[model samples]
Target: MLAALAVVALATVSGGAAGGWVASRDGAPGGTPASAAPVPAELVTAAGKTVPGVVSVLVGGAGGASASGSGFAVDDQQHIITNDHILAKGRNGSVTVELPDGRRFAAEVVGREPRSDLAVLKVPPSAGLAALPLAKPGATRVGEPVLAVGSPLGLPGTVTAGIVSALDRQVRLGDNRHSAVQTDASINPGNSGGPLVNARGEVVGVNTAIATIDGNGSIGIGFAIPIDQVQQTADTIIGKGG
Candidate 1:
């Protein structure tokens, strides 16, 4: 009954039988210090603008299987991006995108590149959605301040702040290798497919992987796919998958 109730919670967020999953795409970091700038009003404002564009990704598959995670808007046409592995957890079923405003929509996989560990999803454009801005290629710099927003442990609207620790990091997810942006953010299982935004609310990377010690959880080490890769794959998916 408890497990069923959890499924109900996810499905309710999806406004249907489909649900979401929360897993992170991050790994261990170099344990470097974060940016020391005092919290500015702009960072606060950025958070306000960002949270609305992110959504909980719920998926339901065969035999009552379900999972939940996080994702963010990339464009005005209702295209959302998430990790391919996050969506794979419920491959037997369908995907659901649940917004912060209590609106829900069914999601379909438009394109998936397991090699890049990225996937794009499509939902109906029912309202004027402000797509989060993606930074230009090579926009990330070490010691830059960043914020990670996602649902951790099924907690929605959760936010954690950190700094860019490194760049051009090669991390492996299964047989796939990706050059990633490293951060000292507190990313966890549920943070996958979300955005890692700069202090100005511009997205620099997609929160994708986290390194855990003993499989416990995040220890201030996380990785994100650079927005450049996100754009390349997403454009291809939109052109072909659509």
Candidate 2:
């Protein structure tokens, strides 16, 4: 029976008939009416632990154009992981990173891998830099609940929640081609390079790009560089300075 159908195609990522799936549902198994459970207190505490590692990144280019993005501490040595786009144009000028406690630092690019849109930056490690843990093996799966922590559109300390929409999705931005973890998280311009965290407060992905809905805002379709790739790339950059 062809019931009321809803075909969810990849809308803006690729301008083509990029295939879709039939969103058909049967019936709830249980007879009792169910109510949504309130969010757990542990989730709130997880966010509290994660946000301290997130930082706001501001870039100023020599041509006078400026941009803002997000990043998070990777280690106690002041190593940071963020989107390469944030440091793309500002290489010749200044890249300022601000912490959750209002401390700011001048960050220097250690390495940038544009293929994955990931970059590594460094500042002198001090007392306040806290490293957020990356999700371990077998820690994630499709439909798993997650959170996006970043500074969206210049507003810092922002956190949004959603579930993993899809996995191993491929998309391109400029010359960068990426296999991303798709989510319905509320990611925006400044959210790039921020952490896409799991419910366990572990960094699972790097929030990269979003598919625009209302002419340049998030309509809950966002893409992220999976943390496995982020970690591999970061280590190569750090150890080899490549």
Candidate 3:
């Protein structure tokens, strides 16, 4: 009887009856020198203008499977960009995007590239969907002030200020070469797929991963997918035959 049930459970999970699994840290890295800067009111104001594009994505399904993450609008048509891990379950689940003005809408996965951990979603166009301007990847300088905007730990519209610690940092994620923008910004759980913008409010990267330990949290080592790659992928996804 137990063996039969095990098989049934596996079949159900494989058949999209179970929700997608959330990504977790292996362990936190050791401490590093603080590089956080006082968030300027100007930066906050700039972020406020951009934050409307940053949205909270809620994925839900039957069998009590659900997950949440962040995403950003990339175009005037309500095209959204996010990490592939956030929408891995495909049509088995439903996605809802919540904007800063308390408006929410149903979203659909238009394209996904798991190797780069990027995905594109689509929703209906509405007012106040300010798309963030994309910055060149090689343009970001080390020690430059930056900010991370996302729903960290499910806190909507959360903003954290820090500096770009490095650029073109290579993080190996399961046979994929992820050239990332490293920052000292505090990116906790639920921040995946959000924007990592420079002081000018131009999006330089997409926050994807962070280093953490069992007891320690946010080791100051956070990684984001470069904006250039994001654009390339998004263009292909939104383009014809994609």
Candidate lDDT scores, in order, read 0.77, 0.77, 0.75
Candidate 1 wrongly placed segments (more than 4 Å)? 1-38
Candidate 3 lDDT over 184-230, as tens digits, reads: 98786677889999878899998987765442446678888898899
Q: Compare candidates 1 and 3 on TM-score and give the better one.
A: 1
Worst 10 residues of 2 by lDDT: 7-16
lDDT of 2 at 20: 30
Model 3 residue 19 CA deviation (Å) reads: 22
Highest TM-score, which number? 1
The reply for model 3, stretches above 4 Å from the true place, is: 1-38, 89-92, 240-242
lDDT of 1 by residue, 138-167 (tens): 778999989999876666677888899999
Order the numbered candidates by lDDT, best leading.
Answer: 1, 2, 3
Q: List the residue pairs that clash in candidate 2.
A: none
- TM-scores, all candidates, are 0.83, 0.81, 0.80
Per-residue C-alpha lDDT of model 2 across residues 1-242, encoded as one tens digit per residue: 53332212111111111123212234445567778567767667778989999998888776576667889999888898998877764543577889988889988888888777788988776636799999974567999888899877566788888899998888777755678899997776678789989888999899988775334355688888898888999999999773
Cα misplacement distance, residue 212 of candidate 1 (Å): 1.1
